[model samples]
Target: METIKISVIIPSYKPQNYLWECLESIQVQTMPQEEFEVILILNGCREPYSKAIESFISKHPAGNLTMLQTDIPGVSNARNMGIDNARGEFLTFIDDDDYISPTYLQELYNIAKDGITPVSNVIAFNHVTGQYETNYLTECYKHLYNKDKITIMQARSFMSVPVAKILSTNAIGIRRFDPEFKVGEDGLFMFQISNRIKILKAASPSCVYYRRNRDGSAINSLRPRGQRLKNNFKLMTNYTKYYLQDIRHYNIFFYISRLVAEMISMTFAVRGKIQQ
Candidate 1:
């Protein structure tokens, strides 16, 4: 058997409408089939969707795909399952609703092999409007190369989101997702690993992240203001400790201020929704 260099981890819920396209994109990746494996973690999906995913996997070339079923109810749990089950030297988290360009995996693989610890590329589309949004660290990242030494602040800022990045699961070690944090688990996971991992940013916009806008979709619905505030407070607390431990005091206050502002805005957002 050929060795697998990359493991694509996809956490899926009842995303029947989008899973086929997402799987198809992976099957057609420009990276040769022998180079990578796709692991689909199906959390709380009904039998019908499971059967569909199975059927798709059966038709694919051997040794390229595997599907695991988990009773876990949240995305965080599903992602953690992926992390635990991943067998590739490099692991990637791709959302079930998103589809990548054919060159996405190959591009990420090329940069990752350059000895960068955690490498991430640009997410080109929001999947709602088919447009890209500027990330918080895009400008700062422009100054850093694939092999440059990165401060904890730079790593934290760059790794704010787990998606759009390909990481060496073996280098920094696989950090499981926090199942308790449904809102900012990805951010928290990235924050925890940023300190121990070197950073690399890919210059391509090949990853297409699709944000579903339908009502009740995880990305669409808003939680209570109190809940949002609580989550933000926890994230800030965690981020502060992570930064302070790494001696990046400059970014600590920035995180606090951003948390406060987001909390305030969330309050008004909740009120507006209630009024509507």
Candidate 2:
């Protein structure tokens, strides 16, 4: 059997036509097919969606790709299953609507190390405008342009999201996304796995993750201010628990201050929401 260098996990729920573009991008990676595996999990919805996905797979043949289905709805649950079945030494995540540049996987694989996480630049592709723009996270990652690596404390801001990054399987171990959190699960999952990551490295500028910025997408969806605050509180509790354990090398003072700021901001946000 060929060695799988990386595994790309895509958790798709009630997907749209954009899924085909995402899959096609992966199908044409710069890396050879045998070097990586793509695990696409169709979660929550079934029947027509499953049949549609099956048809897509049949039409576009990829020997390295594997499609799995589950009645579970949460993206975190689907990702957990992907992690459980991942056969690669390194792992990266891609949303069903997002796609990566041709050299994305190869670049990530080249820079990935047991104690390091390689991050890619995220480009927001406007669906309607047909234009690409620099995303907020990509702007935050500018600090990495000249440096070789930085600690989790330095990369904390942008590290909140799991996209545009590749981590080693050994680094991830058994840490999984918290299914309880629908809002801040990505940040919490990154926090859980941060214990093993000593440094963050930036991949080649060419290694880009094209994030589709469109209406009704999961990232753009909003919840009530009260619900968001509740989710924020739950995330704070989880973050505090992991930080207190001191297994990871992060600045406690910095983390505490961030939480304090978030509390104030959330309070004001709720007030504004109520006023409106």
lDDT of 2 at 247: 37
Tens digits of lDDT, candidate 2, 1-276: 344899999999989889999999999999998889999999998988888888887887767888899998999999999999999988899999999999999888877744567888777878888797767777866777657777776777666778898888887898899999887788778877776777788776788898888877776676788777877787788888888887346566556754774577577657765210
* Best candidate (score: TM-score): 2
What is candidate 1's lDDT per residue for 1-276, written digit by digit as tens?
A: 334788899888887577788888888888888788888888986688889888887787567788889877898888778777777888888888877677778877886787765444444345456566564445444554453555545555556667766877764375577787877777667766655564455435443333333445575566776777677677667766766776642345445544664466566656655210
Residue pairs with clashing backbones, model 1: none
Q: List TM-scores for all candidates, in order.
A: 0.78, 0.91
Which residue window of length 10 is worst by lDDT in model 1?
206-215
Each model's Cα RMSD: 4.3, 2.5
Q: What stretches of model 1 exceed 4 Å from their correct place?
A: 1-3, 117-158, 171-174, 205-216, 241-276
